[model samples]
Target chain A: MGQQALCYDGTWKGLLSLIFDVYAYKYSISAIVTENNAIQSLLFTSALIHVVTEDIKSARVTKGIITSVGKKGYLELYHVFLSEKEGRELLILRTVQYYLGVKEQASKNYAHADVLEVKKIVKSVSRERHRMKAFIRFQLLKDGVYFAIAEPDFNVLPLISKHFKDRYADQKWIIYDVKRKYGLFYDGGEVQEIEFGTENRLDQKSISLAGHESEILYSTLWNQYFKSVNIRERKNLKLHIQHVPKRYWKYLNEKIEMGG
Target chain B: MGSRIQEKLSILADAAKYDVSCSSSGSDRKNKDKGLGNTGAGICHTYTEDGRCVSLLKILLTNHCIFDCAYCVSRRSNDVKRAAFTVQEVVDLTINFYRRNYIEGLFLSSGIFQNADFTMERLVRIAKKLRKEHNFNGYIHLKTIPGASEELIFEAGLYADRLSINLEIPTEAGLKLLAPEKNHREMIHPIKYISNRILQTKEEKKIIKSTPKFAPAGQSTQMIIGAAKESDLQIVHAAQYFYTHYKMKRVYYSGYVPISNDLRLPAIGTEVPLVRENRLYQTDWLLRFYGFEADEIVNDMNPLLDLDIDPKLSWALRNMDRFPVDVNRAPYEMILRIPGVGVRSAKKILAARNFEKLRLEHLQKLGIAMNKAKYFISCHGYIQRYADQQSERIKHFILSGSSSKYVKAVSTQLNLF
Candidate 1:
């Protein structure tokens, strides 16, 4: 056989199971591809999809990676997983391979190429998460559930849930990641991960409900306050764009002019 | 018809914009059973196009003042529309703004409407209603009126997280020249009282867990720069005194934005001293984070910070015998003093070098700004290019191309040890 390709579902657990398959069959794999990846295999290479996602095997692999590289490294691994970066699954597997022979924290040792690659991805994902926390603007809904939407470059909804849960514990709220098509809903008591699968594509106008008239009024007042506080003499749009980039302006109430 | 909340917000927020203290940080207040918001490690909701953080619902209780400070936009002599928010109005606005997550909390200041106590009492009542009645646990920063009664200031601290009294001008002589109605003593009295109470409450809390926190975020003050004739040395000295004695959290420098044609202040349409303001902030950071003293930053000999170079680099150039700090063997303090080596990177160096010797590449990997730190630091297998040269030559090499951009020529004298 020429170079062999192992194809699996594009999930962390699936990737872990593929790693188990490599060791189990003594398979000298040439490349690993996920189901959604668009990269084509070389001609005349045997490619097979590993059907089952073994839970026990994935758990063992996760524990081993965590024990080798600390909790922060493990979290970085997860963040890179959520990043949906191209060739990320294979990169993560390679990073784990580097950790196999080392005992001390390899994450801090940036000399390792695998660790450096993972660190760069982790930093970018963390920045996207922080930007989400700063930019999410909740508009009051008619049912008293404050609703906000974001289309982050990375999957940051899982990261920002805890912060919003703590700060807005007394109120009912919903934060929907429009790009991911899923959301987090927090009642007065607990928060639940929600998904509206294969249904209506909820756009901004569709969700800006008419149930509460004060939503428009409050947003108008906020825009007014935002405009008045800015000193006309020290107008620095370049610096402002550096902090709150144009990519986030669609979600910000203050960025939009009122009565338009 | 009565003025809408939108109109009042516009007027009062515009009036309060010049105060320059928009921070909603340093307080960790948790929401009770029915509060609207909680503050944990302050969050900036948004940044205005001017790049200032809109962290709080910063507004004045009223814009009607008795004193005519020449530099103030809200001075009694200025022809601006006057507006006032009632006690209930202020409380309602804070709660509504906070619920929508538009702010971390409230920063409430007033323009001394009736008297010091009268204005301060209303400020205290608003805080009381937010904490006791509304059960709101968001961060609150109250601007204590100068010459306000001790009792009112104490009560205000009970509910607010931070209390501030602006020393608008740095020196007494400067204050007398422009803002004659204001004096240094009136501002310093409330600060002293608040500082003593903060210390006493800390001791009580150690003994009794239920002693209650008093201004738990501490107090901060502001001074307007370039509005009066005070040297950078004078400003740094006054800031050091406030930080050392009162334990002030911050001393913000507002680069006086010219408002009107007054002989006492800069003429209207004169450019704000933004570059000077930025240099002062860098100097302040050196004092707070980098373990540099006020005199080390600016003394009688060097009264002003070099406009082209940063304060830390200037200090390092003046004291060149301290250069070439070994990244591996240097203590945390010495590493911090090196140019472009921040607190985070210094700690990282200490941590990573324990595993292996740090080379120049290792320092770069740890995210040190090598371009500036290269002349001041030495790592394993690393050689400083200008180590054998005099400090004047080194400074010249760094500023060769940029010297044309600055109005003042580069200093050529080499201070030898």
Candidate 2:
């Protein structure tokens, strides 16, 4: 199958160049690889190569995939690329390209299995987005910076900004997507991206915030509340663990001091 | 006093955990002009290790009591360490917790300390301090002491969002045997008094705009299920009485967890019957929201909720003549009688069918779970074949797996927490 070896400025324009080359090739392309990182090196052996140019007309045609699907779809495509699922990157590109061609008639053929598959993936992502809103727990860090760690099934961190920002307008907070290795930090006004470097440890003991009196008092009170609320007669340890999994207990204030 | 406060909070909060009326809904007051008040959808600031929502600063004024309620951990004769929070201590904790947004407000219930009036006065003082001295407009749900006077009950309504007077047992004999200090008259009198005051306040509000909201969120009561020999029908009847007579916003059913070794209560080996509680809640929803009456749901003949199936489905099976409700022509109330159709699905069917004569496909598109609804409803002259041909067999088939599915759904949601 015909392939493209495209290199652009690591921007949407660069991605669009690759999309334009797919159609221009006039041969159904097998894959497109970015040259800066040798992504999927072994798979590129039998593929044909075509260099991408900064052609505005071609780029605009390619950008139409984003315009047709809206921003949510565009971000999903980005996540699909980041997910590194086998053939996912190619599938997203192909899906976007297919969506661009049949934007208007997409809803008419609801019975089609391909459309159903796309809808399921989109819906699953949306569900995870909503679940994160319900489950995200924030902890008070040493610097009075409220921090929370989440490992959602999908890339939901980007979607959670509007909620946290609105609800906690006065507080400085950081919500780290531990699985994604990146976090969003809001400094009481605006949010910015922060990366947890390779040396950054995930151990709770290592990141201790020593002298926050209110945090300590709150933690103690929470522990008191937790101890008090459990009905001894109806103590179902199995059911309790089932509800609040031991996995999430590390960051939970009530469960933090009481080691699992 | 400090150690006592901590000890009491620990024991009482543990005791009070099973009481699930801590939900703060219905009130719309926001942080008015700078004083700390929030009317947002109540935030659950903490989750216990068991993962239950900690929306309110739930604690008891004291775990010390004069009564020996069989189902209560705080029963006077129990050998557990007892503790009590002084009025100042409770007020301080509430204000401190509220400032930190650690809780919505206080859910203050107490085991009878000294006497009913003394306990009620202490609880009232904490609430008064929170409202007047601190100017707190947060949600507060206080459990009304059964024998507390009308004046204290009035103050409770004035300061709290909701006041609850739990009718601990369904029958008077059960109350007398299990909790001698508490009587049927003591519980009902306060409920009736509060109900009257609530009604009067509402009427007064219509005429006078400046009148304060008296229990704006309204009153609710709890009934301990599985403790006494009361059937689900009798329990539901009590709930109906509270709903109609007392004008209670909710009748919370807490499955009896036998905490004391009293022969008067159910055996300790018996499970709390959470499924029974769930079934009761579903039936209660039908009563309040779905317009199903109590006696029609569970009569003296059919006294117990069929543990195998939901009350709605069981009702549908018994009245098989009402089967094959024509979805297109049936009213909203009639459509609600269909087994799988919930309030939302019924509304959707009404809205969608108005546009066109609904087929099975149209019903599915409206998000009705067709597997359950098909046996109960007909669409565009299409009736379920087995619904009439093998009615008994179909009923058994539906009833068998309903409880398992109900358990699974609850377990799955619990996992999400």
Candidate 3:
């Protein structure tokens, strides 16, 4: 009726299904948040009801949005959802609302605030996804499962799963996001979302398989090769840090000064 | 690998760092048969302290050159540690590094150990072993040896994603001054042979369909800057020649890091001409993507690029009549010509301006550099603010107005070419 927060299950499809009902039932809501997220906001100052996720309704909304703005624009909106930033749900609704109000395509309307904001957010999310692809460093364990741990700034583990799965189709590898405490494990045939140890503080030794000789050898060779290729006359630590930021130094085998 | 292999890797990788072509892109090598790798746009896996990308495990098969090229560090006369890797050792290193995600793939170059064909054969053997024995689908780039037979180069193209031969100097006269035996004709022979074979193979593939891609990434070359007496004009003309003649994918400009104390070249402490190198690269970008001819950027009239401003902005300043371009009405080409607008910003303008007349807010929102762009472009209801300003004043306004952070960065880091 009045302005209220609507809670959806913790998924992009759930949000789309919730938006579908928001339009179909004419429900007035201030924010569309995850059921877990809505609890925090509802405790202070809003009314909310759990919206069940329906595959059929979500499919209808997906088609409607695709018809308004093409697949490329739809992907831009989806990347904003994957970003999971503050006020992201509201921004998506507004951009959808603006496009639905117009006859012409509103995706490229930089003159409008909502469209421009979506462009900015999509760029940032795309950058994080690309960085995850680049910064992921896999270490070979004794069991021969190539293991890597990343704590990206965003929830990009889900975004980069297909890339790793496709590239290393022959090998078994696991990419664990310590911050999210979830991982994607590819077992040579298919990928499965997994959960590793409780703390996510996998100090190098915890993951390093015992008596695995080649792991240490390759890591050492990598660190040595990294240092050797640098031209001392052109040493620019500032530029190096900009490309491989300080926050990711711990995760990378070459960036670590010394380790197991 | 053992400690012996590690030591050899250090020596050979250190020796090979000067080549500076680390890209592992432009290859259509797909991962079939559930094997190792597939290349898309290249990834820079790590950066060195010098801020150069370590995309590939760029290493040499051996550092045992017989030539005494003055600018080269591994010259026969220069006293540096020498090491060699057996073909099997190189294959193991590449496969293992690739598995651990430490690199895109292998970039194998070598110092001439014996005659040209012998050295070229060794390089090809390493590539062939990786592709055939291991079923590796990784990006491989090999350096074409000067005076090597066409058969070796052809074998290399079948395995390597890309092949390159370094011109080493901008002009024949400059090359002869430093390295007496080397000439442009010798380098051109290999490039011509490869280009011709690439064309013939491409034609055969149209009919055969299973011709098995022959160097899908195409060939590229590198020339050292600040090594010899050559102007910006000569350097650009040489690049233009390669682009026109061979359809070269890229021409790398590696600034001369004083590696040898040769009497024929600059003293060891001579500055690296980093600013000049950066400008030349910016000019290179214009030639490749920004619809600019080499002569337009630098000609007989103006042989040197301006150090204070970028080449694009310098061009816009010199051609003063082209300013105040209408944002909404101008075609995509004219919008691209605006000094501060990059390819991304130019595309955004073309897409966004179709709905309505672009205003100041819209232009800023599109992420074009408004600090420099505002003087050159006009939008809805906005008159040119500095209409009658001279080129010198505009250049100063653009430079001094830019953040001090950029100017400070130029001193330390070499900009990407």
lDDT tens string, model 3, B1-417? 468888998999999999999888898788889988888758889899989998899999999998878989888888999999999999999999998888889999999988899999999999998888888888999999999999899999999999999998988888888878777799899998888888888899999999978888999999899888788999998998899899888999988988766777767866676778788889999999899999888999989887768899889988879879998898888888998899988988887777888889888878888998988989998899776899899888887887644475465433322
Second chain TM-score, each model: 0.94, 0.91, 0.96
* Residue pair clashes in candidate 3: none
Error of 3 at A237 (Å): 1.6
* Per-candidate clashes, comma-separated: 0, 1, 0
Residue pair clashes in candidate 2:
A228-B14
Candidate 2 regions with alpha-carbon error over 4 angstroms: A1-136, A141-145, A152-207, A235-247, A256-260, B1-8, B34-37, B40-54, B88-104, B131-138, B200-210, B351-371, B380-382, B400-417
List runs of model 1 lying over 4 Å from the truth.
Answer: A1-9, A12-32, A38-46, A49-69, A197-201, B1-3, B400-417
- Candidate 1 overall Cα lDDT vs. reference? 0.83
Say what the RMSD of model 3 is: 2.5
Candidate 2 - chain A - TM: 0.71
User: Whose DockQ is greatest here?
Assistant: 3
- Give one digit per residue, the lDDT tens place, for model 1 in A38-72: 24544423456453588998888788878988778
Q: Looking at model 1 chain B, which ten-residue stretch has the lowest summed lDDT?
A: B408-417
Residue A88 CA error for candidate 1 (Å)? 2.4
DockQ of each: 0.59, 0.17, 0.77
Cα misplacement distance, residue A56 of candidate 3 (Å): 1.0
lDDT of each: 0.83, 0.71, 0.86
Which has the higher DockQ value, candidate number 2 or candidate number 3? 3
What's the residue-level lDDT of B309 in candidate 2? 71
True contacts kept of each: 0.61, 0.24, 0.75
